[model samples]
Target: MSDSQHHNEEEQAKIRTSRALAALTIAANAQISVEDACASVVDESGDEGLDAIGITLARGEIYVVQAKASSGSPSPTEVLKFNQGIRYLLDWDWDSLGGKTQKRRGEIEAASEDDVKVIAIFSHFGAQKTDEAATKLSDKLLSEVNSSGNILDFQYQGLRENHDNRNIASGLGLPDYDLVFERWITMNDYRSEIMGVVTGDQLARMVDSFNERLFDKNIRAVLKATDTNKILDATLERSPQDFWYYNNGITIVSNSISCARTSPRTADETFKLQGLSVVNGAQTCGALGRALRENAPLEDVRVTVRVMSKEGHSEDFTKKVTRYTNTQNQVTNREFVSLDPYQQELSESLLSEQIQYSFRTGQTLDYDEHAFAFDLEEATRALACLTGVDNATRAKREIGRMWSDITANPYRELFPRNLHPATMYNAVQFRRVFDERYMASSRWMDTRSGGIIKNSTYMACALFMQKARNEKLDFSDIDLDVESWVSSKGADIYGLAAIVVELHENENPGGFPMSFFKNRQKIEEFARKVRTRFQETGS
Candidate 1:
């Protein structure tokens, strides 16, 4: 044969070999549904039933397998049609195993190596249809297969080929048994199962369970589209040493316009420019203060920072500024060194410094869940202990408190002075914000209703802010007006309101409208009421 002809034949042979190997690999090792023709056994009670094995992923993918023996089974063409239906109903993805896309077939290649994730799959089922009607019904299931990347359907099919003769085609396997199973799983749905497989809460914490790889893809895509590198460097950083962190200090500053200032400044004015800086600075300091709080014992809390520069002038300048995270006061006195003296000559244009602050405990970022938990622990603990608590009730109460807290001040620690007004946060402002859900609880609801409750205390604070603004009023009468306004909203909104009102009212008898305070007791009580009422009652 000519070389070209021989090469062409070899290519075709490779293709056939590849296909055959794939088919055999799947048939031998893959979990499959087997059908046996003999009647299934019945219990002494004389009930008619067929038992089969199946596999499932959490709301994700499902594979059902059944085996049957038929001496005169339908043709392979007929079986292929039936297999299509099973793939559709169960929503299984076909295996391409790293191949180029097939436009006509509408097949998608696997995403990236890191991107594909295994969903929790239960097992494979095998069973024989109970009757001839059932057998024909299986034939009707052939219409559902598709090649869309977005949908999961059809993995592989297997039939018993070598076992018997006169069985015609003898055995048939369709992409993992279709048979109209119930549900498909999403990324979030398989979280628990993923947790089981990956074996680390820390890993799960860093990466989104199912969508982690997807998220990383999106982040890169966004950075690329925005040309964000030119705008700001280092999108992800494990430490302050990242290039973005040390950009010519000029580039590191936020580019947005600062707010305007007025005398006897309001938050609107203070949060604009100078006030925001002060607020952030103070918040950073506050994080340090909370870490030092007496109740929470912390160890290995250390802070060391220094700036190195090529020029002596830069060395002097570095000393003028304060450096610290929210650690202890003892950290303030750490040596602010000019490491340049210890090193060889430095250039005036270049500078570097290591500022290390470590807190073995009590280092809480303003929005960190730990910080929030610390603030809410007192109340949550007590409430959770109640005897009659239920799941729905617990969900509602906890959801309400969580939303209330998060929405009330997402950036509070970061920008305390210019805290975004609650009303301005359309995402979290509605009464329904409190009705949000955690990962698991959402499945229980048919409609998934009613989680957040803006108790009277919140209403009081909101109402106080609203009325004072509307009436061209001063906060001088905050206690009286807040109480009255909260009372008007309803007893429930007012219930927690009264407690805070009385507490604050006593702290400042002369009437102080201190906007921020940690009322842990109240926050937990609210969380408990929500957890008990919603979770226990399944409301």
Candidate 2:
């Protein structure tokens, strides 16, 4: 054969192998079909940086994938190019990517910006180098960002040719099983109406069969070595009997549910269930699986289960049940408010304006979930500032009080159902400027004036709003970037600083400003003094 012909053939083979490896790697990581993964791959000529990318539906995180079909792992240059590609995407430099990738701008933008993953995968030939390469990449990325908790990280994988992707091809394999529930009670049309206890042995059997796919569709459901899982591991290892009370149990949504027809089925001892998928309690299952793998003895451990059959329910309603039921126990109060219709509506409205509204504690971002975005925590602080001086003080001193009982007074009054979305946008924009300009940059000095302004941030914002409205400053706009109406009000926008400094000095002489800001009586006096200044400045 001619040398040119041999070289061309070799080049073609390399391209084919690389594309094949890309499909397999994405399928393995995302648990999607190889067909879908192949379709998402960027095969354009100039696209040397990224090979393929996808978003995880469960966590709403964007995962960028790079595949190397050569021996002994992808070279350092390939890794650097992959990192550069991700940086380009994050910076929104769409023109630098291929045409197909640029067309996906909207979908890419919609995914979680605050949390992204870049997976670097190699051919099975590189299996021996995978672990060491993965560790070095992780360490290098952390060092580059100077943050262990950064929004981006590297994950390395070696795709074995012998392994079957069939199970995972079906997407997070919770294979059709006759789910057995003990002492079950009937609740609706699909059968045993939805309450039961699942035995530990049953979970053991399922874990043995399903592996990591057991927790698909769960909220924020990536099972790692989290502190929550650590507690679960300890409990399962040492105290199996008390597991039921400590664990929040699992909530399942079945494609269909059934039971034996022997007598009235409501009081049955157990029954058959097909297509059972857990929407919550992934941590419990993971911990139990870990314990069993280590040969830890388990006794009298049963998980309380609630099943929401998808027979007649709307898609949105079923999703709501899943999101609400899946929250970590400590954040349940804040997370539960996500079920409120108003919060969802407001969230939708804010999206067009580029502001990410986070009503749920575990909510994935809509626009930008990072610090610059208008988030729920800052929104609450802004609302408290506008609500009254007392609320402002409480908001700074103890913000958790607002979210402690979402259905009750302080939370309800601050985020009433009647509250309009525009008002929230305006308030958030107003307070966000203060936080970013002063608090975030540590622009405040240890001097008394700096201390006063920094400590009384929320209260000062509240008073600023009052004075601005009297001066007729507009507050109805909601454009996040191109138009932050509140922040653009010129030098006079910070006219409240002089008033705040004077108020703090006059009301709490010789006292620490932090203590003064948190004190209700002192804040009330400060607000009164600011109002008096606003009125008397007519001179």
Alpha-carbon lDDT, every model: 0.23, 0.62
Q: Residue-wise lDDT of candidate 1 within 379-496, one digit each (tens)? A: 2222222111232223222322221232232212211333222212211112122222121222332210101112122323332233334555332221223334323434333233
- Top-scoring candidate (lDDT): 2
Whole-structure CA lDDT of model 1: 0.23
TM-score of every candidate: 0.20, 0.47
> Per-residue alpha-carbon lDDT of model 2 for 292-390, expressed as tens digits?
766776547888877766777786755777677755355334565666777889888766666667777766664434333566777888889878788
TM-score (C-alpha) between model 1 and the true structure? 0.20
Can you tell me which runs of candidate 2 are displaced by over 4 Å?
A: 1-13, 59-62, 90-93, 113-124, 127-138, 146-153, 159-174, 177-180, 185-195, 199-539
